[model samples]
Target: MVITKTLDTFDSTKKLAGHSFTSGWLLNSLRENDKLYSQLFGNRLVKDITAFDVSGGKGFLSIVLRCTVFFVDSVNDTDDVYTTILKIPGFDSFKNDFLTDQLRTIFTEFHKSECDFYNILAPILDGPTPTVFKTVEWILDESEGCIHMEDLTMRGRTMTYFETVNLAQIKCLIQHLAHMHKNILCSDTKIWKEKHLKSSTGFIEVLDMMNESVEVLLKKCDFEGKSLK
Candidate 1:
């Protein structure tokens, strides 16, 4: 089950599942170095943060949260609550498993790749994407990485596990991918190829584990008799 609670409920000294989710961490994750964000949150700091787990049956790569922020001073009605999507690397389900180390490495690398893309390529790419307010790669510690992005709950929708994409949507996605690939190709191809290649031998080493996961999922779906195309 998912839980939603304020940061005050968690003890500052205690480590939460080998990770820290303190208010200080939240503040740091939400902190943006942009001029506009600075001006918007000028002189006002996060009074409290309430995180709601929204990652059920979504993806196993990371933890997804809908975080609501309350400022110290509620000068206006709009200052009451601010919301953003908070994503942290690591899966709670695999915390105690033997796969924890391998999964952590994979997830952390994926998270860092995303952070790098947004930090380096998104500006030049010609595709519409969510605004990333803040993104950090895993540094010395696993808890040091996070992503605070625009809340697109109202503006967009997500597909279910068994849902199939329609032709139009697929075409649109292909068009966007084509545009992005064109932009990338026009730039330094060698740099991008060397840095972002994912088909290396090390990457494929985890394919067996991934296939095992998919088999388990397929068994569950078969039990439910859900037709997947």
Candidate 2:
């Protein structure tokens, strides 16, 4: 995996936003986008994380979520904080590459899959779209290629995940993703039975699994080679 601090490591206002980080390791989690926001908002005791910035995609977009209110009560200041979600292009060499676009498309498909697998993970993954709390009142910034949700606090309310990583917690996270897949993606309830549907279904599924552009290019190349003979 080319995963690195090159993603969320340092703030480059020079590049996009004038942000800086003391350590690169701190950004490893943020490189994936959603993980960074989850860490920030999921912590109940955390009032804030300073120098907590994200930027380093093709476009240098940035935003910070405040964890706590500085004053006792200021509706004007509001109970919410700021967080940023970024829109980035993956390729640098070409305007866009077939494999890179395929990966992005795969993420979108994964996001849909999350809704399908939310209740049964391990065998799957969940990609969540940003959503704020209506009852609690928070802002969920789900935009571009990233999900940035904020307006989270350490106050009262039954549902809260604000702590470090643990085995049980990991399991819980997995279950959560499963639930996301089940609920959001509208899972295929009969996977075992669905297998018996039809041969064309399998073919179409395989077709969907592939990148159209790649397939087309491959066909064109095959035709040209045959023509040369």
Predicted candidate 1 versus true structure: per-residue lDDT over 53-96, tens digit per residue: 77774756677778666676667536466667777776555535
Model 1 CA deviation exceeding 4 Å by range: 1-21, 28-31, 34-46, 72-80, 95-103, 139-143, 166-168, 198-203, 214-229
- Per-residue lDDT over 89-183 for candidate 2, one digit per residue giving the tens place of the 0 to 100 score: 22222233333444444434433333233233323334433332111111122332222233333332223357557799789778877786675
The lDDT values for all models are 0.66, 0.35
> Candidate 1 — worst ten consecutive residues by lDDT sum?
8-17
Provide C-alpha RMSD values for all models, in order: 7.9, 16.7
Residue 109, candidate 2: Cα error in Å is 0.9
My TM-score estimates for the predictions, one after another, are 0.70, 0.24
The total number of steric clashes, by the backbone 3 Å criterion, in model 2 comes to: 24
Candidate 2 matches the true fold with a TM-score of 0.24
- Scanning candidate 2 in windows of ten residues, the lowest lDDT window is 132-141
